[model samples]
Target: MILGFGMDVVEIARMARILAGPPARAERFLARVFTPAERAYCDARQDRAGRYAARFAAKEAAVKALGAPAGVRWSELEVIRAEGAPSLTLAGAAAAAGARLGVARVFLTITHDAGVAAAAVILEGAQR
Candidate 1:
């Protein structure tokens, strides 16, 4: 069953500014907001701004879908792609929050275009 749903949009320019800033500041911002894998994946892309924006939106959407639980860190929710399909892998506080909420799995979708990035998330509950 569907436990929760959420969607978010981000401006590509916002992420671009953070990435294009001074090294130390950029690193700090990235480190606080994104996981290592997510940083690697987006940094490897030609359109890093779009990729990062999409991932940012995905993280926000995941948190909203998870009911904005306390102590859920941003880096704990990773946006992963396999064979071009996007999904969420929660760890740390995010995983614990999901467990508490009975979220069996989280479905994710992300898209970017026209200087904007968007993501949608659906939290599925465990079978009773």
Candidate 2:
């Protein structure tokens, strides 16, 4: 059963602007927003900004899926690649919130196209 659903869309150009900033500036934004694994994965891709944007959307979607829990931090919700597909894991306060909300499983999917990036999350569990 599904408990919640959420989706988000980001303009690739927005992330591109951030990535185009000075090295330290861009690093600061990336470091604050993404986990190391996400940074590494996106940095290795040719469409780096698009990849980053997709992850950003994923993070937002995950938070929405949890009903916008206040304890969840940006970095605490990680977007990852498992078996060549997008996956998500909630950690720290995010995990605690998910547990409290009865989130048994998190389903994630992300895509980029025509200068836009988007993501959707489905929270599956015993319905409340």
Candidate 3:
């Protein structure tokens, strides 16, 4: 059965501006919103815009999938990769939503091309 769902899109140019303006801001934003592995992956990229746009889309998709605000204190939902496959980690409001929806796992996919980035998320619950 379906537990939750989310989708998002982001402009590559907007993400590029944010990354260019301040080094520390990017660091802070990444720390608050991304997992360690996600940060590492994004950091390793030469094209920061692509990474930032992908991350922005992922966060928005996670929130939408949760169907409720992720508590403010926790990092927003994060998307990472393992063995080149996508995975998820929820925090704060996102985590609460997952629990409320009886979700045991979240599945996500992301893509980007030209100046656009997009993502979709799906939450799967444990068998009843």
Candidate 4:
């Protein structure tokens, strides 16, 4: 059963600007919002801004789909690379939200093109 669904889009240029701002400020934002592995993956790519923006959109979509409660930190919704596709892992408050909603599976899709990045999330509830 489907629990919820959500989608989000972000401007790559805007994300680029955010990531390219004052060193200390940008670092703080990145460290606060993204996990260490996520930062490493995006930083190693040529389309760094696009990767970061896609991940950000994915997080936003996941949060929306989960109907997560307040205090759900950005880093708690991590985009993970799998063999076939990318997936999301919830932690802390995010996990609690999924459990509260009985979400058993999550479907995620992300893309970047034409100066924009977008993501969609589908929350599947556990079967009885």
Tell me, by lDDT, which candidate is best: 4
lDDT, each prediction: 0.92, 0.91, 0.77, 0.94
lDDT of 3 by residue, 72-128 (tens): 333556676668767778776667778888988888888899889998888889887
Which wins on TM-score, candidate 2 or candidate 4?
4
- The list of candidate 1 runs beyond 4 A from truth reads none
Q: What RMSD does model 4 have?
A: 0.9
* Clash pairs detected, candidate 1: none
Clashing pairs in model 3, backbone N/Cα/C closer than 3 A: 5-65, 70-93, 70-94, 71-93
Candidate 4 off by > 4 Å: none
- Give the CA lDDT, 0 to 100, for residue 49 in model 1: 94
Question: Cα lDDT for residue 87, model 1?
Answer: 89
Better of 1 and 2 by lDDT: 1
Clash count, predicted structure 2 = 0
Query: Candidate 1 on 12-45: residue-level lDDT in tens?
Result: 9999998898989999989999888888898889
Clashing pairs in 4: none
Q: Residue 69 error for model 3, in Å?
A: 2.5
